[model samples]
Target chain A: MSIHNVIQVEGLTKKFGDFTAVNAISFKVEKGEIFGFLGANGAGKTTAMKMLIGISIPSSGKATVAGFDVFTHAESIKKSIGYMSQKFALYDDLTVKENITFFGGIYGLSRKRIRQKSAVLIEELGLEKVANKLVGALPLGWKQKLSFSVSMIHDPKIVFLDEPTGGVDPITRRQFWEMIYKAANQGITVFVTTHYMDEAEYCDRVSIMVNGKIEALDTPKKLKEQFKVANMNDVFLKLARG
Target chain B: MSICVANISKSYKNVKALQDISFNVKVGELFGIIGPDGAGKTTLFRILTTLLFADNGRATVSGWDVVSDYKNIRKSVGYMPGRFSLYQDLTVEENLQFFATIFGTTIEENYDLIKDIYVQIEPFKDRRAGKLSGGMKQKLALCCALIHKPKVLFLDEPTTGVDPVSRKEFWEMLKRLQQKNITILVSTPYMDEAALCDRIALIQDGKILEIDTPEAIVKHYPKPIYNVSANNMYKLINSLNAYQYIHSVYPFGEFVHYTDKRAEFNAVELKLYLESKNLSNIRIEKTVATIEDTFMELAK
Candidate 1:
């Protein structure tokens, strides 16, 4: 495998009993690339993502994440990647500082390193005034931003974001994408899934999954051209509806 | 008017959930409440549906006062909350039957009301509600909401987290339902869906920012907007934000929707400035403002 490829998969498949949730899917994610993984509801996106994040075992096929094999080095893969989902990221009862410290500890950061990182993160997000407040008390936009920062506390090689900007205001949503762009510029591979089609255009490459199989995979421009559509939303509607 | 809310205000301890909110929905019109989460949309829906009382002001639904005539309002209106409130353990058919029974009606009496939507999920009638897929569950929820054949329908963020195809299908169903003379008050965070409504009210932080047709709302934007693009999106945004003439810069799809602080701005000059910043392949074109752009400007 080339050193530039951070995530590599070959015919990766996941099945439950008689049902195949994720069919044989193969894709590569390059270093610092923003990859948008999109699909319709019940399209096995969650199943595929679970396998990539090392949380679930793949029933068949070969995959490597962050230079670690999915079958043999799952724990190492976990250590080399960060994950944040819209539903659950940070603890509501914990303060912003406490959430940071707790996640830092989970990633096995040194106490001194955690302290230094927490200071920088709090300042960067302008959360200094709310550092002591419970995460639940903060606005939805603030909590999502903080959750993303805490996910990167360990400085993993790749970060997985699941619908991170769902239901956010238009301004805050753009700010969130700006943060994503910054992370990518700093050489972190972003594997994100979102329901918003406009966000699909922001990715360097996007893969559309349908019925447990990948139906389309390319840059947003190429996908639009290939589908003979003006935008990603129409492209999505055509493929998913079919 | 099918629904009318006047000078409504509600508070929970320190948070003002809704403040002096007022709006009117014409009969048989598809009205939308467009806002993000915690914008007091659900609070307004609750008050109008008579599930919760406002600390001040009053509302009437289907010609009945929300408080004094809540019983009549509840009987004449259908409400689908944001969360899936159906019984998880019940089968789809059972759930539909239960709703029809409660409204003192039968499936045969109102089958025509939900025929198009219900037929899509009819094959899954035997499946448990909890086991249905996201799209199927939404269709089932809509079916339950319409089983009573009410004159008004209240849908709260029905398309939140739902995919594009299903969302499109859901909107089409709403348009068809409008022909039946049902006034629908739907709320969604998606600006794209706002255009599908006959009229929309943009709300934020316990207040209504603006209310008008989506076309009129976009025209309310005070400045010209431009679709600016370059080879490097990240660097392009930072450089434009650092420029002196920048009024607002927000990333929209493949390009950044930008506006200038000056009244008579030159695109060539701005392109030259970006070129000096080592950016290449710069493209700038005048673009129409969208509901999202108008919303951000109003919310700002």
Candidate 2:
């Protein structure tokens, strides 16, 4: 019930028939915080995210996103949050400008506001030259940036990014984190999942999931200290080995 | 040399995949080709494995020519491509048997070479390859590749989709294989894994930027870097970028990796500059360069 907490969950669980994909996990995310959700493949990170984002119903638990109950107000939660999946969600065939306008329209943005926002976004991302270019023709790094920008076109209160910088070079990954920092600075809660341990260090706090359960959750530094490891990667190895 | 490439160039239509790439791997050495996607690591692997011919180059694998002695090269090399190419419907045991039979060998004949990996997957021997978890599938793939006891093993992005724990275990297994005198050539986009290899080549835009040990690569970074942060990280990056005395600035996790234009950069002066801009909670300190920092410096 904390006013500062943008997301609150208690005993959130999901099951696929007899298989429990997400165990009774609980966590609270404060407004404008970058929350890192770390887990291995098939560790139920995606299923847990789906439940929090209001796309998947939990079998048993209490959850609230942006002050709305996940079960009763999933529609309102959807409108208040933006999501970028592991796969690029923008239309590849659409031009940079068109993709922006399209996503903005889907969020109930008016034509005038969409046009103004598109201009500012293109300029900010250094995409003015390729504003009319098809997204398919852009490099992977540029496409990722554009997709992230499009996701935030409506200025949602929370953004969920899944593996935003997969396969990108170090430089691009660094720049992408800047964008996340920028969003969080403007009071948007960012819930992200990534395999890269270095990215875990960027989070204000991180939760490591193992076998459908959250094995550890804390600031990266504290988790590293608790596990007697030098970095988040070693911390993950220690917890996952258990 | 266990493997060698000279003046290798490859292109498909209008796009250049590799440009004048050259490197050598010694006997029993673990060599890593590290780069992002579209960096031509796969193309280089395909050429050395004799699956694809290079447009211009001479190469050898285990002292056999990649082109003229391709058949001999194939016999001496184990290649696990980027994708899982095993029979999805087939069980783990069947896949191992199938690979061994194709190489004109039996599982029992080369069981010693794959005993460690095979034992882990043996409990699930009857499970379909596709039904196994990411880590289990990788173990099966490694076992299949080692059945014939090939002198050289080529693994393309073996740990890409696997979890961090499995990734650590995979590298440990590779170290054990190294003790067996197998020359391992692995490619991955992960910079952290580069440190695990004996020597690594950082590739980008189809060119090898640097080839050396991970420690040596980090030592080669020619600048004093600082980790800088403030309350407004986004504005801090922009202000740092616009600063007159800054050489380069890029975000690194929670802080920015910064280098000043002056050789003897003053951390206090940088802090004062941020304070002058009304930024609070400022923290700046000299930080050691990592393999990733070195890669970015070289790529730039």
Candidate 3:
């Protein structure tokens, strides 16, 4: 059965003055599904994602995220969705627990809920010993994992992760995906943008953006066959060359 | 005797960069510190190269402690930071000469060590380092690092921005470097590159998850995999994933990789069923699990 659509975009376009960052494009994301966004560096993936997450406004086109209009309901959309950026998104001076609390507070989570969530998240992430430790002192992997958990602290219906696994090891990437699966199983939709073509293969569906246009959108397997390529990398090569 | 890290723990104030990290790189071993940007690979490389100090552990390279004998340790090791930190105004040859002078050596004396890497970019030696392409810059950087003939080399995400073909050529240079019997500690976020390393330390945050040969790690992967591909791939993946018997339906190449969801589901029946879907010309076959798959399996 086709998954119910949770994210809808009709002719989404974003123009930065004269240049079009994200051209008129359209796609939909299903509720509780893992949607991967793939593109090369400087491609419109980030632009399109920023528009969808409400950080960047679209010049034209309409979008609804989690059943809320991305234009007028930007605040409510932000409330219902979590975001993890490409750069590490935690304060280096704060302790592990403090970082979680800070993010939770921003999401307007109750102090009690923050405390409870902190306890569970810390234990689940194997960060109990580092609860009082400063986040800046933590390794890249731990910080990444913690950042991920922090993004979901408020139980947002949708989460936007931007290259959350950029320089992490294979093991950490795997663990990261597991966390994604756990969230997906819990019915939280995941929308992630990444440059790594292989990582794009992990998504239930992926859209490839090039030159502000979504040239290809499909499951990884279909992309390879459609492009007459061996892998997602080849699919991207073909799309980029075109 | 070697590069040894014991119980290293560090935090950046709000982020944990390394947690009880420990490892050893022997002479002549091409050891890879595999992880994403925040995985503490850079922090560890910095600590080992004496660029950064560890908070709660001790590490020694060539018998010089990273914290105490930092100067001595720095002198004996070559380092290529994640970002391009070389002098951009200087020409390619000038940068190499400058690095050589710092280590009390001359480029002529060590010409053989970097000949393979340097020759390709020799034509641009007079060109400023800043103007070179990503691949050429990489070559110059490697040449500069190896000029001193250091016993150990540290490269942090050296292939981040280069093209795939360039990346392959860079790795070939690394293999040649290893033949010179220098211990190499390199970090990369790409999973496919992990297989090329003789041994790797899979790091995240600040912790060491596993240290083993790449082959051994893959040998430990426990999963049965199948490949499925057809026109309109996204719909097929959704359909396959919805099936009760399909466990995982990830895209691998020109095909979607499907596994038995129920664990006991047979491959033969699954192949027939996949053909029944809108997908055609299914190439359903059992294939070897990759490092990424192994990582997922191990992480779970």
Clashes of each: 0, 0, 46
Question: Highest lDDT: which candidate?
Answer: 1
Per-residue lDDT tens digits for candidate 2, residues A1-242, read 99899899899999999999999999999999999999988899999999888889999999999898999999999999989975857899999999998999899999999999999999999998999999977777888888888888888889999998888888988888989988898899999998888899889999999989999999987998899988888898888888
Error of 1 at A20 (Å): 1.1
TM-score-based ranking, best first?
1, 2, 3
TM-score of chain A of each: 0.99, 0.98, 0.96
- Docking class for candidate 3: incorrect
The local distance difference test score of each candidate is 0.95, 0.91, 0.81
Q: Which candidate number would show the highest TM-score if scored against the true structure?
A: 1
Chain B TM-scores, listed for every candidate in order, come to 0.99, 0.97, 0.92
Off by over 4 Å in 1: none
Please identify which of the two predictions, 1 or 3, would achieve the higher lDDT against the true structure.
1
User: What docking grade applies to model 2?
Assistant: medium
**Root-mean-square deviation of every model:** 0.7, 2.0, 7.5
Interface RMSD of 2: 1.6
- Residue-level lDDT of model 3, residues B1-300, one tens digit each, is 478989998888867889999888888899888765666788888888887878898999988888889988888889999888889999998999999998999999989999988899999989999988777888899888899999999999998755445666789899999999998888887777888898988775567768899998878766577667655455566678778776565655445667675657576676667677766766667788877666555544
